[model samples]
Target: MKNTLPIALSNRHVHLSEEHIKILFGEGHELNKTKDLSQPGQYACEEKIDVVGPKNTLKGVRVLGPARKNTQIEVSLADGFTLGVVPPVRDSGDLAGSPGAKLVGPKGEVQITEGIIAAARHIHMHTADAEDFGVNDKDRVKVRVGGERGLIFENVLVRVHPEYALEMHVDVDEGNAAGVKNGDMVELIK
Candidate 1:
């Protein structure tokens, strides 16, 4: 029998506050505050662009806010395709390269120099699902993403909470590198 699991592509991002944005990018840089439609307490800011990984030069991307301390830049798989890099969700301090502008507004001309960031990889599961999966909060496990681009993702942290839905979150870079698309299957390989 084939091993198959349901996977959902995370195109959503949690925002950081204005205060944290300044610390990463530097003072005087502006960050636009916006509400996250899905989750409360989550806000996005239009600030600096973060170029992750080894390749230098600006990749065509627009970083959104709220600015976070360790976790920042919420890159989509589509954006990763443009940059041609796999951005693992990680702390802001871990990101390489100088800060760049994230254009906002209608014409896509507004610029914020705060900087782009990558959040840490995590899985959110409801209480019942957590029990079914036989996992606990902060438990580390591996995820097997199957399809044309198959990969075994290791070191994925599990976050069990009543408010959360079952899903795995990865940054734009990682999604692109793995060639993951919407409605893909990601099985727990614990």
Candidate 2:
């Protein structure tokens, strides 16, 4: 079976905590869906905020919903430099000892002690898709993208879930370095 997945370029974004959402938006506020994301039941919300990093502030960062137990900020390496925080590359929901930032919203601001990160590249595969690829959850793999500017990405995490969509997620920097865009196919390198 062929082992390939479409790449999904992930830009700078924030996933708010339920407590923070109410503080930022208001009491009993909910995010509005701007568009559906590749992941099933996940959508881009209309809410946006500014994250104040150590050295600089980044504005217009979109917030994804629904809220989680804790808030997390995902940014590219370039963004980390702009904010002057060296974020560790980690999988989603793993924020131990990661960076933190100040988030400014319309209604209020949140000073987070930790939760910022440069998200590690990963592939979201359905259970059947993982079987086809011969991979398991938490496994690290390599991905090859070919073109005028080809690149091989290592340490790509494989996340397999029944509800996952078959897509590789990379930040803007990684996508630009490979000269790949959203919907570009990448072959798995065992």
Candidate 3:
């Protein structure tokens, strides 16, 4: 496992706050976990919402489980272009100054002030994994993917935590461009 990490392709998804979840799915309604994600304690919910943008609407956008402090919508650059919102490539939860969109649920609709973003590519590493890779939290590094469309990814942020598994996450666009799929191995450029 020398400088190797598995890749996970992230599609467009939404994370709702408790208040927003209540407003969207109705009072006392909790998210139904359909499947567990790579991250610990996070899951994909059975519920989905419609994201209405200035230009178009994305229907059936899956909502991630485990309510967050703020509601954030993560989209790919292509999705952003389709939605007519230029969401910045930000880390998860770094939604300040990002674009906002209208989220329509079965119960009601929520107009977020600012939460949409095109998430930056990053790696989640456990403390032991970071120690093995010689990386610290928030450290940016380059990653090499080998394939017919092989390319190097730069400025990939490292997030270190005890619960985090060692994996690299990229948007759908990035994965497609690199000709990589989920579970593909990538090398950390030291």
Report the lDDT of model 2 for residue 50.
Answer: 97
* Candidates by lDDT, descending order: 3, 2, 1
Candidate 2 at 44: error in angstroms? 0.4
Using TM-score as the measure, which candidate wins? 3
Better of 1 and 3 by lDDT: 3
Q: How accurate is candidate 3 locally (lDDT)?
A: 0.95
lDDT scores of the candidates, listed in order: 0.56, 0.93, 0.95
**N/CA/C clash count, model 2:** 0
Ten-residue segment with the worst summed lDDT in candidate 2? 1-10
The TM-scores, one per candidate, come to 0.54, 0.98, 0.99
Instruction: Write the residue-wise lDDT of candidate 1 on 1-190 in tens digits.
Output: 2233444445534344455445445565666654552333444455444343334434333445544554344555444444444544554355565233343222223233433444566777778888888888989889887667778888888888887767777765577667886457678866
- The list of candidate 1 runs beyond 4 A from truth reads 1-14, 18-71, 74-116
lDDT of 2 by residue, 1-190 (tens): 8687899899999999999998888888989999999999888999999999889999999999778898999999899999999989898999999989899999998899899998999999999999999999999999999999998999999999999999999999999999999999889999
The model with the greatest lDDT is 3
Model 2 scores a TM of 0.98
Query: Which stretches of model 3 miss by more than 4 angstroms?
Result: none
